[model samples]
Target: MDDKKLVKTLFMVMTHRNEQVGLSLWNDNPQGYNQYCQWQTIIANPRAMGLGKRYIESDLNRSFNIPNPRTYEEKRA
Candidate 1:
């Protein structure tokens, strides 16, 4: 997520795989920023597709903001 230009970001939080979006803070940052959790969470997420930097190149890697919740698009499948 840091490597590519962030098309968007949610300072609060996002969804957890197999669960629901905005269910909870995936993991508080060192400064308590409830972002997309740690780097591991990004890789571990089923939604992440394990693409890493390549994930950024794909359309799914585009920023997904949970603020809008269920209606927004994210390649959850």
Candidate 2:
């Protein structure tokens, strides 16, 4: 099979979950998608694999150069 044919034959799926928001997926159907299922398993058990947890009070994207860092959040900036 050509590249296009092979790609078409393969099954693909993507899923995401946000605590503040909700669950989402690119392919709503997951039946017979072994690779996709394996990926979800890894994501679900991230802590078991030594992954870091998300910050609660502060956003990592907001930290940048500032004249004065007064508060704990500011110091992180």
lDDT of 1 by residue, 1-77 (tens): 46344233333222233333433334533122223433322322333333322232233334365444342234331
- Residue-by-residue lDDT tens digits, candidate 2, 18-50: 231211332333333343232221122122123
- Determine the C-alpha RMSD for candidate 2 after optimal superposition of all C-alphas: 10.7
* Model 2 alpha-carbon drift over 4 Å, by segment: 1-53
**Span of 10 residues, lowest total lDDT, candidate 1:** 49-58
Query: Against the true structure, what is each candidate's TM-score?
Result: 0.18, 0.22
Please identify model 1 stretches exceeding 4 Å from their true place.
1-9, 12-53, 56-58, 61-73
**Poorest 10 consecutive residues by lDDT, candidate 2:** 14-23
